[model samples]
Target: MTPTSLELSTLGHRIRHQRVSHGLTLDELGERVGVAGSQLSLIENGKREPKLSLLQAIAAETGVQVTDLLSTEPPNRRAALEIELERAQHGSVFRQLGIAPVKVTKSMTDETIESLLGLHRELQRREREAIATPEEARRANTELRLKMRDVDNYLGDIEKLAEKQLKSAGHVSGALTHRTVSIMAEQLGFELIYVSDLPHSARSVTDLENGRIYLPPASIPGGHGLRSMALQAMAHRLLGHQRPTDYADFLQQRLEINYFAAACLMPETASVAFLAQAKKDRNLAVEDFRDAFGTTHESAGMRLTNLATRHLDIPLHFLRVDGSGAITRVYENDGLPLPMDVTGAVDGQIACRKWSARSAFDEQNRTTEHYQYTDTPAGTFWCSTQTGTTAEGEFSITVGVPFDDAKWFRGRETQKRATSTCPDESCCRRPSTDLAERWTGKAWPSARVHMQMFSPLPRGVFPGVDDNEVYEFLDRHM
Candidate 1:
């Protein structure tokens, strides 16, 4: 530990007293300050000396001042250390959240510190980016959620087939969920804490104190939509969560993604290809949409929402549940009537109540109810809509295109749901079993594997070698 320059006075007494006032046990304080209980006990008992760094950490955690820890000198200096410590910790947390820091190094001179203070505005700008673009830094969010759902299903099978109930984890049930969320959270260098008081019926919570993310599973009318919805919820976690502060901008991003994903999967060429092969399709049947676009039903629905808005010829809006259970949709045709604020039982918000009304996979009892549409001063948005599912429904993807399209349904109806086909080398879903099979009985060549590896290994092929080819030649000959 780096030592601090804090002086000894009545500071040790003040530190121990402040720890108690803050409701932290000696061990708790020790953990926060990077001290052991025995060491803390000695410091508190005045049997051992106190270091400035320990005092700084304590003041930071307890909101006490280093000066207060020192002599009760001036009232202004009394809590200075605590304030500085807090400032440092907050910067660290923001960095954890993918925001840039105002300034990293310590500055002893007032002028240098003022220069650092000027960097605060830059920090704010970075924070704004993080808040505005939850979609950024989210390459695998959609895929990760889908894979986790598969993992969850695999776990469910194990849980069901086991002769005896697995030991109940009680409060630690969240631990099981944490394991799934942790992989991403760790990549982001964040800590996920389970908070019971989360505002919505989210599958998990994030930033309970500063940022609240809720994941509500979507419920389709019949049992048909449950698997898709559950998977969607997990995907929603990858998007990360926060209540949209700017609804219009947020909605715009939603619209853009809906459109982009659709365009990527069903380019004008692909659309033309479908038109040439089959004519007079209508309803944009989910299965047909998936196959036509080479994407999952959920992805197809997302594309439909954006595509319809962009082409007007398609004129459709769609809602689909991904593997994680989030009910995401892309909407088109602004003039149409739909309820925007049909949130929950609570007035004026997004909702998850319909899905919660029944178990996810209950197909027989699944049924559609009247959808509520609310007209807004700006336009129309969906209030609520319900659909039914078949008892043995496979994962369903639903697409709703305008009736004006000549062959929407016929082209869409006979199609089948498609599996994900996007290729990302770092994909967590790489077919390990397939790779193992492909390599069985074959001695994989190292040179071929090296060609596929990420370029610029940790060091050049050989350190201090200006030319890699030269080094390779020497290695081969020597």
Candidate 2:
């Protein structure tokens, strides 16, 4: 096989080392090997590849095997350091910094090279830590969402795995029962153990050695929350996940496990069948799907994004916005105009106040879903939003489709309509002319800054998880 650049560099170092050790000058070695001294210098400096015949001559003259001259191992510690420095200088990070490459010479001490390598390593560590920042995390999330949108957010392998597991548990199903969830866990060699004391940062913890899945004793009403947590824990094992090495890895693993859990909770075969029938009846609604599967409105809405485009040929969008109008989660393939930052990230950006997701928070009768037809710059889209509360705060879950596709949904005839000029400063970001004149320069309101804006992601083998707390909890349980 052709050697890599680094391997060839090491080979050159080995050849040079062997030649020097044998007390041969470059000119003498070049004459012995039937090559010019200039060419031999180039080979020794790793700038040229030597022929096998020339290598054999050098190996014979130097009293070493041909393999010795071709060995990838650096001949000495200094040579290894030099190779490392060269490799680091050639790296993208170093190149992006626009710094000139440091040239190593015989006069440069080994200590100086070690110091430079240490700085390079530190730079790499800092760069990795910077990726944990919220802006960087959002950028990564945005990219992942676009990729999911391209594939209609479907994972056939994961869907099949959920189906096989459900089949193994004898779940033919309306709503997946708690007992069935336990049976699935047991089949995977795990026992469901409910406990009062779980780590504050963790939802569920799995003891691989003891085959125990520890869960919170008190689950949310209707048991859907408990089932989801249990399924997510089992999914880590099912998906063969390793400890995340970085923020992006952590985000990916989190998405995969959640997808696995949703797939199990709302089995693909059953969900598609139910949706196909609903579309046939022209009664497609997120609440009906939620009730049918016994899942949260947000879960059902997201699950629809997974199936709607691929199975029903209907593109759509999903959104979860906090009461303050900031988007918490979003996915779109229907060309809805959602707010975004310069990085193309929608997370934490404020949704247009005129959109149903934000307006639903003000509805007097929030017991039912709010439906609206919004005319955006892109097109007119119909959305159904349901408002709910959690420990964190009030939020809205919405599922929407283009105006053309709204005919297949239940709330298509709703007379409520709105017009949004979003992404424009005048839309919702700016106050009315009179109000702006009245409040401008007179208001010095203190902004409520979220801690996440300034802080990096939690540091650990698992981000945001306290290892010591988990270990203590596990010890107490044992």
Candidate 3:
């Protein structure tokens, strides 16, 4: 490109000054800017009007701006970039000189900008190659597994994250979905395999066709049901390539799906048979039950909790409560409908009331409404359950065990505050007796266990559940 006489001279002079200021020898500047030292000298001396584009090239190479080359006011547009490059160059000089290059600054000169752009492109290229490489893929898988393990460690953290997300949107992040979960899983190393069958033989399976992973759903008997839908939703979350964001939606889906998964792990028929055999001798103990089924305590409790639903005589839900009296997990077996969010209410405090059972069938049926004080080797624990429902007709049944039981899963000192003891010295429950330890190693039936825990409807919290109204709302869209 041609240059105006003034612009050329202006550009040449800027280029010369920038080159010298940046501490670049003529040969170094020439090599960097794609111009020979002799040619550059001629241009600097105003013997020739270099191509306008050449001025851009020199500006870029020297970390100066094109406007700087063409302007006469002070340093021009390129001066800032040149100054930055000079600082960087000066730092390198200091480093070579055995001095600390402590106060370094960044430059945005043409050459530096070009170098940055080139570096970005190069990094992108390398990333593409890394993704395609088997070794890199394996490394990615290892990293993903490590992350998943960490995720398992902070399930409480996950619950908190979910709760925060739910309170924000009444759902998780919209971007969190099955696809994202699957992608994350693959990156973490576990393969996601999707299947269409209730109680699928495998929760996850490898897909040889595409050499990818699959997380299949537990099938429904007839291949249709809300439960199936929930399972599929969870599959999308857990096995798919997306991380789901809707905490409430995710919980609704995950619990329903995994309830079936845990159910299918030891199918209902088998569980019933085993429980029947155990009942013949005695109520199944926790360790014996876990050993017989080779399952976690929570898993075992869930299976047992499912019992009350099928048999009315055993109307109960089992939960592991923390010192703060928060129910971390709930398992339902005896009752068709149990109170929902039982976990949320008793989450971080001791339930110091007798177990109160409520039902959708009878809102005021109070069974075992009195707390029985008990003592045991471990300590005293107040345990109870009450039934209530949100205005939406979502039921919640809650039961609490001692916070010390948490040690079964985690080896840690039991916090006294969880047993209803006050944190402050002036509090009433101070020096409170250990309710759980008071009754430890006892063979009390569910009803006879001594602790004060109950669930009643939250005064103002209501969830809506009117199928007809829901249908009507949908009809409006139709």
Best by lDDT: 2
**How displaced is residue 211 in candidate 1, in Å?**
31
Q: What is the lDDT of residue 286 in candidate 3?
A: 40
- Which candidate number has the best TM-score? 2
The better candidate by lDDT, 1 or 3, is 3
lDDT of each: 0.39, 0.90, 0.42
Per-residue alpha-carbon lDDT of model 1 for 1-478, expressed as tens digits? 5223232223445666688778988898898788898888777544566777877887789886766666643123323443343354356434676755443233455555545545654655444434422232122233333343233212222222111111221211211233333333343444443333333322333333333333323332332223222223333343453443333334433433333323323443345445444434333344454565345545545544433433334444444433333343323343332223222111111212222211222334333222222222333333222343335332223343332442434432222221222123222235478786888678656553423134331122112223434334334422
Query: Which parts of model 1 are misplaced by more than 4 Å?
Result: 1-261, 275-277, 281-284, 306-312, 321-327, 334-336, 342-397, 401-408, 411-478
Compute the lDDT of residue 333 as modeled in candidate 2: 95
Model 1: residue 463 alpha-carbon error in angstroms: 40
Q: After superposition, how far is residue 315 of candidate 2 from its true place, in Å?
A: 0.6
What tens digits encode model 2's per-residue C-alpha lDDT throughout 430-466?
Answer: 8999998999999998999887667766765576777
TM for candidate 1 is: 0.28
- TM-score per candidate: 0.28, 0.76, 0.28
Candidate 3: stretches off by over 4 Å: 1-211, 214-246, 323-325, 331-344, 351-478
